[model samples]
Target: MSTPFPSDETAKETPASVSKPIKSAENASLVDSSVALGFPEGGFTAWGTVLGACLIQFCGFGYTSAYGVFQDFYTQTYLTNSTPSAIAWIGSVNAFLVLSVGVVSGRMVDRGAFYPLMKIGCLLQCLFLFILSLAKPDGYYQIFLSQGVGFGIAIGLTNIPSIAIVSHHFQRCRAVAMGIVVAGSSLGAILHPVILNNLINRRLGFANGVRASATLNSGLLFIANLLMRTRIPPQLNAVSYTRILKNSSRDGAYICACVAMTAFEFGYFFEVFYLQLDSTLHGLSEGFSFYSLTILSFGSFIGRLTAGVVSAYVGIPNTVVGSLLISSAVIFAMIGLQSAVSVAVIAASYGLFSGNFIALMGPLVSYLTPENSHIGARMGIMFAISSVGSLLGAPICGAFLTSHYIWWKAAVFAGSVATGGCIALVFMQVILKMRQKASSVCSKEAGV
Candidate 1:
């Protein structure tokens, strides 16, 4: 006689009882684990995560993009006799710090040390901005040291950790999430200048305008810090820096990519400075340069959003390549057009190109590296190294401009750099493909 539940011996022989209980138990266990993990039953919280990431990116990267406005104001009002290169250092250092500090900060976040670092960084950034606000006319060095260097350090600490947390919170819709987050920087770039322009025109002057902007940024950062808590479990192990560097292998292509990025930074910064300077030279009123920058920022905002959607489909490397090529063409075109239409075109093109590059860099580093663990260090190295270009590009261009007003030459220089950047990206793609093929071959061989 058979029992209500078949005996193991009988089940093995009967096949009816053999599979059902085991399958039921397995399904029950899976449901239990899913409940424990707290992951949504299906799909991901894409919208919420993307919104959070966007807010953080807007605050962290927005100020960085808006540096062009400060660069223009400083050069024209306070540092008139200072070399463009000299002034460029302030922005370069800020950018460098933002990029370089990621190595330590990224590891810290991985190690569960995000809160203290972020708090300190936020406070320091706010203090520096306040210090910059108090700067006297011709206090170029003070502003540079305070806003550029100080703010750079602050951003470096905040950026990677904030981004890392976003990665932990979402899985399926990461690209869209990242794109939305990064677009905040473009938004900031667009909005900040309008505010600054209003204040400057209202007779607040550059110092007062900057101070007000700084206060607003500081308040926003303070709120951001409050909201920047981690939503994921910390990594159990520290990421090995040596391994990260080893994998990044200072190959010819990698070096070339760095060079191209540097050149891009230089050209980008030069154009930013030149736009305002040109407005002045063409006899536009003080407020006009800010308006032009606002236009450029608006273009950048649209560009970043477009790049996100495009990169998602065409591939990040391809998107980067396409953007660089288009940017080069735009720079050359800007040389001849003097009409408002031409200026708007140039501004929009610059914004689009710059935004695409910025959005692409995060994915590009991932594409280049072997593991995601070292993303922070690799990014830091990239930023630190590329900053040399930022340091020199403007100065060299500025030196040429000092003797005579050859704005077209600067545009040519920009175009050439962008073209080279496109070439470097092509090589990077080739290397990545080869590496993937090698990886696949090794796996197959091991299986055999």
Candidate 2:
């Protein structure tokens, strides 16, 4: 409950008996106490939470981000009997789970189960990673069970909460904090591949390398659990899912953002999943192609940070609309890349613009929310809807290629979808402005 305001008795007595400076001090104390009940905004503990959330992203989605390297290794060394498409299902399922599980995990966060969920999720990830270390060579089902399904579910449990937790500690600085947190995945993407490739290819074999990585991740996750803390008191009263959905459905801005998220995700993974192969097909060296994802990820790291800072000044909606348009243009430009330099430049450019959506999405959801308490459930619905695109987008892009890869077909398809999402973001922005204007007009007419 909010703190009570000063009573009318105090106001009456202040003018007659209280000194001016004393009255000012009383008002200031009240304001400070009220603000304390809400977001801390910035403090040592709040930033510590951001740091811990970053580690969660590093250990969770970071590994998933490097799945391209894993896929390449499996296709060549261990899982040769399985068709590339069949093996691709493993990564696809993992991606789907990472976002899809938010449907339940998000609600749990709202109900004040953040720590329990984090602990369980981190444990599950370590457990599955260890189990993944034991799978025999050419054992497709074993890998699928341990790495694909088991690990995916584990990451899913923590994925939404990592982003949602930031809402508790930050209000004004939230955009930048979320960006920094999500940027952890980019750093992980860059580093994990180097670790996996060197250990698997030159030093330890697959099983031992996975075990080593799992040990390292366990330590990091332990640190994250200790560092992260929830600031908001959870609502104990149960809220109906049907009521939340019904309210969200009536929101034009929320619906548009959902559609935009789904469409943006539909095309977002095309470069991430296929860039190395596409570079190789277009005549880039195998060594360069191998590092293509790393380069893209590095660009994304910078891009996410930049987007976060810029959005604070320009506003989140403006930043998102600009990012969508630029990203769509970059995807379209990919069709013309012929030389090694061109491929590298385009990959970096695409990463720079595309990274904006990742950083701003959490803040965008919070902006659209009518109540702070609804942030978790609304974010869950958004992620679950967008997971559809993540699950299917890559497979559909792969289908566009013949036995000999025709990269342009996929490029054209992906670009067009991103453009569609861009248009929707613009529409969402317009709707938001209209609603604000209408609300302002009503307030003025009511003489408030």
Candidate 3:
């Protein structure tokens, strides 16, 4: 609760009463372009940053979105000895590291270490995927090292900072810009499967196909390195990372929001991870199963924009609730989709809704924090915490499978978990609104 403006003049004149100077050396660079700093909102530099970030997202999240195909392949061919649940951990580990290591990368971004992180991320992402191409059919450990650990670290370093830099360029359209930037993943989702299917199923075999994808990635990372630039330097020592965590954790609303985010992430990738498996089980052709991911990605691309634009009218948290609620229903309905067409429809709908939900994840972290300066660190901490869910969700879902591959148990688990996340979000929303109302009343009384 807000402490009312002190009862007496002297109490009101305490350290907290002192207004922070706007143009101080520390935060002078942190000011917005539109309101004060005069940076162009939609100029070439700004749009370049967006495009650059899009490439990074496409490379990182979008490329990995195809892990389902790989998971199925490893189970069916390469690592036949390993259980589907074990194979699922490789992808889960990737998702885990991508988010969990944000603590390091996020700190670096706050301290103007963007280029260093990007260079490492770009190199590691390319190098490890190539290394992955060398692993043997039973090389479960090798796959985990290269793809799950190395690639996850690479994306962790690269992804959040990529989108954060875009915020440096656009102010009013920042949300929309972020939505478009994230939509890059969906675009990648659409393109990578076509590229992979051509290579894996049609032209080259698994080994050669991976090498080809790695080669393509080197070029994309080059562009990303070129175009992504930070608009202004952060104020050194602006806030201690520890202080931000302690302060934020003390807030009931922020804690509730984190719980909500964790729940959503827990079930987020289950759909992507199992989409192909389910399609193949339903008697769809191999090509059709692969193409289902493309359909989902296409829908996600549209969903990202839809959520961003709609949130502009309603609200971000509210949009998350509504969209997640719809997506959760689609996820449940997907359990009954015996035909390719039914699978496509559910995949598309889920993509649209889940895309918006994904786009808002970073923005919502920034929203929940008390200080804008702490966004990167707070986001890092938040993702690290939530990555626990992403890390375990798949394994848990996989364990529910039976010997017969009647995977309805996994489907039910995914949907139910997502619905639980939505419930947490609702609680968070109520708490946040109530706190804002309380603070406003306290401000009014002080003024009187």
Candidate 4:
């Protein structure tokens, strides 16, 4: 981050408006230029933020991933009176708010409210978890409020910093950094469900299990809150947020990519929430059912890291297209899956593809953005726009499940919609590449 100004020669050669974007590539090269940015990239402090981001993301997304176990338990027992669709609303609302509330969080980030916002998020997340622990016996509304809305808002609040801090620190290794950060969520997905499953089965029981997780996450969140720092703080009031929104409209490929994100999210959580239930229904033993989710999470962990490495070489859009195609194929293949072993294998494949998809999102957004003028606003808008699918994806899947009493209907919905998403993504990639090629030809003609 050099000052958002062009040198005199460049200014003379290009219009002021054009100069800003001309430096975008150089500015992103936050590599070993300590004078431009306040700190050098890949330092101890930068890596510290990466670690913190990983912890925060792990807790935030881990909670979402672990909800499948909770969904199964509640439907079969505590919230048994509620329909599957209704009960699924808890996680849906959670995912919805986690994404939709990002507008406010993004603003807070631009205003340099990182620590305070994250602190609030930490408290609220832990408090809501404790509330959920107490509310299980009280009924659906209570669980919805605590685990869904409250916890979601909390995660949303903290999520800005978790994502933003990476940009503040790394540029050269950004994809790799983000991959590592997201892998935290994968790790959490594995640990939380396993922890909860053991506790619910032979250990502490449901109430204590939820409480234990809350306690554990409280500690982790606290550490992240301490270690995650916003490097090169944003200048408040500098970004014209409204203007950025308007500029975004000019980028058709970006808009199409966002749409693809929304569609993909529509089917994103289907297996995450249903695999264990499917296992149980298909007559797999209880312990194995829980372990299946762990397997998926583990596979996802590998996928995230591998995607990071691959995307670094292959480019984000290409990597995304590849992953989306694979994930779509896996989802469609689930329609006939019956045996626990087969389902488990499919789960791992889905995990690899979907994890890669998630891992590449940050890089994809970075590529689509023409300038880095308002990263926070861009992230918030993209998240809010894409959140609708997450809001309803699980509940709709639950409807398919409840209606059919089998996996076929749910599989159909998730798989078909996921394929639609892949098509949209492919079109987006084409549009983006075309735009880039046209820009390249224009630049060559100009011969600066």
Candidate 5:
């Protein structure tokens, strides 16, 4: 919450180019207000923004988490002729856009476009869900276009801004607050699969089930629109995308974190998309497979809540690194899961660790941000870059799985990729510590 800029004396010593971002309207306002009065941290508007963000996460990423249910359903009945790899593209693309399109939306939020983006995103999300419900049982392209592309874009527009807006209201408790917000996705993931599973497979049928969800999402998004308010005004003269990219590329810690995120995402969804299918293939009861997603999401809810509280003590980077390591181990353990109890344990464990990554991602980006104004842009770029992994990971995992459904190869591939991510995060953390140490030594030598 301190001024995002150096003192005028310090500024004189700093190069003009180095201080350029400070002049931007967004950054300037942040510098002025924070220097004069600090963040609210917790108040009605602030908590309301958090509440709104939670709903946004619930509608956006939370619902996206339930795509595995859709994946299982489509593979078994709807898209019967499609290969698993082909079917996975639907979920991959949905996840990809959910993260990728943040580049545009995040930047827009920085420029004070949150309300417009949120409104349009909410409307688009509902519209697309309705369209998705209209698709025929065998209509692969229709489903792909409606649910995959349209819904993804809608959520992408909402997700990043909902996250970025929190920085406007809270700083000290940002991690915990964002953790609660991200946990909304876990809540959605928990409930949505149950709703979709029962409605589509048990009672209402696919189209009506989707319609029911769409109707529910519409109400939730509408409430979010009303409750969430941005405290920071837009930066009319925000930095250019090229400059944001150029600056981000030069930050070793940022680059390393982004790489870690990409690698983490590459392996993150195998369990989410494949758990039910795996359970069914292993001769588990339909009832168990149907609720496996719910169990995983329930673990995620606990994990996300735990992450914020834990990160307060361990630090965000350290917590993230630890989570990545455990998640990779869980993924590796999936090689030959057969017993229902064993599979259940692994699913829950994976969900717990993986949920940490989601909860901490925004805080991590905020920690790395050079200025408050860059929060949106930096998060956008990071998510956009990492989205490539989300885009490709599932289908690649599916391809690794053969016609005979050899699960170990995909497990190896996913776990190994996640391990690579853990290493990157470890490296990033070390670099951050070294920087902090060097800065501390300089401060001491300068004698304040």
Candidate 6:
């Protein structure tokens, strides 16, 4: 029964081969190389990584959070006759660009391309904002092209890289870290309206107010660049382009998540802009509208934090589905209410769901993807689809409002979309459960 292979006793007695030493050296070299490339064995401190993630989020998402301010001003001052749907496209384009570019940029981050992209994104974002500052009231097209397209690209490039970096730096505490980071968007949402309102109500006028906000945002973006300068470790093997296009079970979840998110975006953007419009129409003080939005943002901040902690225990998918259901119910309730207090409740409720959905997305995407390699691209695709919803939601809702339909009718529209999203999430959960069961069965059969 002797074979050409050495016996166990003989192998034990044999001198270790030269390859053993070479392999040991290679492993040591890899560890050293990883360290040199900033791949800390234990990763970055959770607090520091979260802070960096928050800064990036502030710069990238603040613009999104600030859309209400812009939409209000644009409608009232520059484009009074413009349809809500039409005005939505500007913000939609911005949102789309922010998301669409993420696909490529995310892959770049997974490939160790974060730093350069971050630098370029920061510069371009600042430049675009500066250009946006110079936009004339009449220059709607330029504003759409510059602020929407340019800013979108910059945010997309910056956002995904920072998010991926956080994922690289943390695992167990990731949901909490992501929550803290995503809360920056709510912070921006809280501040942007107040800043815009103060600026507009002051002698400075809307243009000056926008310029001031843009200047401050530019500085914040620079700070984000400085704070978010971590490098990612390269993958051992590069993923082929074809693989990027292939749909997996995870991709189904991603698509469902994206679709749900899109519906949320549609409803959210419509409500924010329309709330302001309704407030103005009802002759409420600008302060009231601003304060209402602040309250919503505050609720969102709390919601994100709560969802993050809850997701750790209840799981992201379950939390997301629950949040969507709550959001849907709130939207349905909002339809029957007319008072300012009721509207504020609706806003706050919407914020809670919005924050939960957004904060969960990164972690969910991580769970669904084969590798973290295409996090950016997948995020981009998700957002791009969501942007389509945003682009259309406002205008469609506006059309409903302008056509002599009751304001509550618009709520119905939004509620219906959100309900559809909730249904999608349910299906996504079923698919996930089935897959998990199948995996368990396979493992049992394999005796491991």
Error of 2 at 222 (Å): 2.7
lDDT tens per residue, model 1, 250-325:
6655665666676677667666656665665666566665678778777777776676688889988788878877
Weakest 10 consecutive residues of candidate 6 by summed lDDT? 1-10
Best by lDDT: 5
TM-score of 3: 0.86
- What are the clashing pairs of model 2? none
Task: State the lDDT of candidate 2 residue by residue for 1-448, as single tens digits.
Answer: 0000101111111123323232332233233112224466778888888888889889888898787776667766788776555666677778888888867786677566788899999999999999998988889998988887899999988877887788677776765676678777888888887777667766899999999999999999998888887755454454566777899999999999888888787677777777765676677776777787888788777777787688989999999889888888888887887878877888798778877767677778878987755665677677788887777776676667534467788889988998999889988989999998999999999996
TM-score of 4: 0.86
Measured against the true structure, the TM-scores of the candidates, in listed sequence, are 0.80, 0.81, 0.86, 0.86, 0.85, 0.80
Q: Which stretches of candidate 6 lie above 4 Å from their native place?
A: 1-52, 167-176, 249-255, 312-315, 366-381, 403-406, 433-448
**Candidate 5: tens digits of C-alpha lDDT, residues 87-159:** 8899999999887777778767755677889999999999999999999978999999999999999988888
- The alpha-carbon deviation from the true structure for residue 156 of candidate 3, after best TM-score superposition, in angstroms, is 1.6
How many residue pairs collide in each prediction? Answer: 2, 0, 0, 0, 0, 5
lDDT-better candidate, 2 vs 5: 5
Better of 1 and 3 by TM-score: 3
Report the candidate with higher lDDT, 3 versus 5.
5
lDDT of 3: 0.75
Alpha-carbon shift of residue 28 in model 6 (angstroms): 17
Model 6: per-residue lDDT, tens digit, 118-147?
889888887887787677766778788887
The local distance difference test score of each candidate is: 0.64, 0.75, 0.75, 0.74, 0.80, 0.66
Model 4 spans > 4 angstroms off: 1-37, 40-45, 167-177, 312-314, 374-376, 436-448
On a 0 to 1 TM-score scale, where does candidate 6 land against the true structure? 0.80
Clashing pairs in 1: 54-181, 85-395
